[model samples]
Target: MAVHKVSLDEFEEIEYSIIAIHTPLEDYRLAYTLNLILELNLSRSAKDILIDIKEGKSFFSKYTFYDCKKDITWHLIQNKNEVTQRNNKKKATLFFDQNLEIPAQTYLLPELKKADFFLKIEACHNNFNVTKTVAKMNTIATINMVYSVKTETIKSKNNLIF
Candidate 1:
């Protein structure tokens, strides 16, 4: 419930009931800030972390998560690009487009909320199965990450696709 502005130096010793990180910098600053938070030994006591990166201009801390054993929730509102498979394409290619950064933002929230240790990983592939697998390994509790895919939108009728 408590929110505060934290600098790189202050992050190491911050003792707030709930830490809310709103960093506008990207990459180095973001990595340093997140690293500071993860390195802290207050995972068991912290709760409800809100990170705002909507205005972030750099991509420094794009793939890192805090390591804490608290009920943490992140409210990330940003726009980013994703790589998806193209229909009828034989080779792997990435198409860059602007889209809501929901997958990366909410991917680990549930696990972090129930975990005592922070689980930091790179990109959360746009697959619910991958998210669930990572969550299972990180949290102590049983939580499910599910999403529904429309059958009509799928180009391939392969049932073994995972």
Candidate 2:
């Protein structure tokens, strides 16, 4: 009789790049701007990234573009989703009782809460110039700032698998 065991190293890991974007423009507008500037055809995905939270499920907008020529896939996703939660406890006033709705924000990466959005670049067996891409994104007037984020420091890395 023989026994065999598999090691984690046997599995191939997906290598990707992360770029944090701080912008005031909405997701659609930002996607359009990126399309025009970066020559990418980013379109909204049919299904959004949903995360289960204590309050409720938070849906984050996702835009995707795949460059077949370069073998690179680009994903622009909203890092924050504001969910409105209704308070079950009713407030009694002089006139009547009222249910208050409070707005709660959920972040994909809690450590990077300040980042409005995150651009994920996944290149398979191809060289991608992240610095040049970041430079180009910085040219956009609507974007306040653009910078690279080290994936090693991300505690909630699983949240980005989608």
Candidate 3:
């Protein structure tokens, strides 16, 4: 008898494209604008992408749209999640102890910290034209900038899968 082996690397492969978006508009407004211009029915997901932090859990806004015809799923995720942590330990004061609140920010992809948002497109087929899509996204006035992100170079690329 001969033994056969399979590699998990083959199973881990995922086909997806990431578009980095820089915009000052709020996540909801941005999603609405993209929906109108791109003809996408993006809606807020019931559960947001959450990450556990030293203080607590931080949530990032995420909107999703699925094109059944194209067999593609679109995810619009906010890169930065702002969280406030309070300092429980109080220093001795003259009267009362003051509780200080510290603000912190967590990024989905720490390597691309400057990007305000990321549009991830996952497809089983290879018919999606990323360049053309980026071009269309650039036409939106609300979007300050839009460009395709090379997934190969991302250190935290696995985070985008969810």
Candidate 4:
């Protein structure tokens, strides 16, 4: 599977899509990842895409929805990028809280601004690299920063989940 940008040609092929919204406020940052994933899961093809990417494939931005599957079993883990505001601008980061049930390739990437991205790899349940823990927040197990697209066009190849 791969992440590609959706073009005008494949509008009909898109089964489902998630658009992320990030707001940098004074006290804490807000991300609409949960809303997006929830919407995506509601689509007809979301399940298929999620299952495929669990193998850890590679996807690009800007593509079509004809590239997905229909056997997604796992849910999009909690948003990892949700962070509190800090005085240092450089310290701010959007992290995806990866879980043991989810695969590696089927994980979340950075905020998408334009274009699309895809992954095709199965991450291990015990992956313990680049983890982050917040006070009352779920611990982030892995970090897979993908691409960002400007247009609403999103193309997913596969996904990671139970």
lDDT per model vs. reference: 0.29, 0.94, 0.90, 0.27
Of the pair 1 and 2, which is ahead by TM-score? 2
Candidate closest to the true structure, highest lDDT: 2
Candidate achieving the largest TM-score: 2
Minimum summed lDDT over a 10-residue window in model 4 is located at 128-137
TM-scores for all predictions = 0.18, 0.92, 0.90, 0.18
Model 4, stretches more than 4 Å misplaced? Answer: 1-14, 25-107, 110-157, 160-162
Ranking by lDDT: 2, 3, 1, 4
Instruction: Give the 10-residue window scoring lowest on summed lDDT in candidate 1.
Output: 14-23
lDDT of 1 at 113: 31
- Clashing residue pairs found in predicted model 3: none
Q: In model 2, what is the error at residue 124, expressed in angstroms?
A: 1.1
* Tens digit per residue, CA lDDT, model 4, 13-61: 3222232322222111111232232222311232222222324443322
> lDDT of model 2 at residue 59?
96
Model 2: per-residue Cα lDDT over 1-162, one tens digit each? 899999999999888999999998999999999999999999999999989999888999999999999888999999989999889999999999999999999999999999999999998875678999999999999899999999899999989988
